[model samples]
Target: MTYSGVVKVGGPADVHELTDLMISKVAVGPMHNNAYLLRCRATDEQLLIDAASEPRTLLNLIGESGVASVVTTHQHADHWGALAEIVDATGARTYAGRLDAEGIPVPTDVLVDDGDTITVGRVELTARHLVGHTPGSIALVYDDPHGHPHVFTGDCLFPGGVGNTHDDPEAFARLIDDVETKLFAQLPDETWVYPGHGNDTSLGAERPQLPEWRRRGW
Candidate 1:
């Protein structure tokens, strides 16, 4: 039985595989925020990223997978709309960057900092705090043993450019610097970026436009 590639629009989880991991994206709510389900193939242990909206849909997608934790990419309301409900239903521990933990409506079980390691099943994800999109915005990096690395960048990065920085010069500079140095400088070009909203892109695809995004000041 082969797995289909269709990402069910406005409904169930859209499943995809990356080496030993399984990733599912479920688009929810008026904002169409993406809620990702990450599973480790060897142990079947799962972790969800951003329980954005529509608790029922999110819960349905998590069926029988045995979720270990839910990590919110940032404190933005759109990112954790269903967080409380999902946590209550699954009893899974919650994690978020320490700087933004207080802004969230629910209590954070683990306040992660930059360089901290989060063990999911047999693999590990490293936390990189990318400021300016929000004070505590984070990107989770999972390096596959056989293939290119994968990153969940939340709202700090996207296909065309860096995340929205609200037109503030300082904020823009901070975000651009962190993105350029911490992300693009360190990670390989083939690293897959799964953002908080919309479609996915690779660091290789967005690397060249770094100068343009900085110049445009968006």
Candidate 2:
């Protein structure tokens, strides 16, 4: 089946295949958090993003290959609901943003920073730290060699706008600025966005609304 990037809490995951990677996206937990299982085609090594919830389902998705690493996009509870359990089960190395590492209950094996490279087999994902939603919200960028770029934006970005800032103007400003400079400006229009919750979108689809989002201050 074609990859739609649409998933529900209890539905089956949507898998996207690329030349060197296979991205399986599933929605889990009450919050409808999206967890991504990335498998490297070359080495068969795997990595998971967000381990958000439902350890059993995640483990099943992981299968016998297991995962080499689990990256928490941010320190939010809903985002890492199953982090400890998943980590315990797979013995996967835990990675979190340097600033939000302390907020996560599990000890982080790797503290990622902006521009840091994380590898799964032969595939490399670049971390882009976007501050605002959380002091250390990181977005993982995978630039596909054969196609467009793919971004896993925890809660910092979404389809319509950036993540909520609890009405804090300063926080919203920082988030919008970081998203524009670090993401929109840097990436191409075809960049596919995989958010923490809800459906996926592209930078091109959202580029036109940047000014409106800033003006609305969300």
Candidate 3:
């Protein structure tokens, strides 16, 4: 019943309060990226998603937030670079899809794929395989009473455009199809989108721009 790379954060969500989402944006400002911590009040479990940049600083943030489980959307360094440090600092289990396994400095303890869910303290994150930008990329869905589900989109899908697929000749095209089918089709028009490298946005906000994206043709 025990797992590796998984540990406890001292702060409990109820005392910390989960209703507020208790999200602290680490490595923001000059770094200007997001590493979100979702604290569940009922169970006092914290889920850390994506290690933005600056591992030590991120750990400090994690300690402050009380994270329990950490999951990454992709294996790319920018996304996966801090895996070792964060894992070491907090002993939080690292989850990544099988395809992106090679990119992790140390192998991920939990291998997640499409439709699989990782339940931390009080949050349940469903995984969706979305390949294109990195041959192996995925998105995590966080469902709440809020208007729409929250998606952690790595380098795959952004606000206006998806991630660049420079390594793969057909990466851009595949990502377009991924956005249209896997993401947009299944998710509600108003689902919130948390991308790997930009400000927060939502599906409804990006709806109008889909046509423009299609026209640009990757």
Question: Lowest summed lDDT over 10 consecutive residues: which window, candidate 1?
Answer: 1-10
Candidate 1 per-residue C-alpha lDDT over 52-103 given as tens digits, one digit per residue, 9 for 90 to 100: 9898888888897658899999999999999999999999999999999999
Each candidate: RMSD: 1.9, 0.6, 7.3
- Taking all chains together, the TM-score of candidate 2 against the true structure is 0.99
Local accuracy of candidate 3 as per-residue lDDT tens digits, 1-218:
21111122232211212253544444332335556666665666777778746676666666665567788878777776666778777788888888888787776888887889887665677888887887668888877664457788877777687778774547777888887787888888777777776566788878788888767765
Clashing pairs in 1: none
**TM-score of candidate 1 to 2 decimals:** 0.95
Q: Of models 2 and 3, which has the larger TM-score?
A: 2
Ranking by lDDT: 2, 1, 3
Off by over 4 Å in 3: 1-21, 28-32, 64-66, 167-169
Question: Rank by TM-score, descending?
Answer: 2, 1, 3
Error of 3 at 96 (Å): 0.5
Instruction: Write down the lDDT of every candidate, Cα atoms only.
Output: 0.88, 0.95, 0.70
Pick by lDDT: 1 or 3, better one: 1
Q: For model 2, what is the C-alpha lDDT against the true structure?
A: 0.95
Per residue, candidate 2 scores C-alpha lDDT tens digits across 36-93 of: 9999999999999998889998999999989999999999999888989999988999
**Which of candidates 1 and 2 is the stronger one according to TM-score?**
2
Off by over 4 Å in 2: none
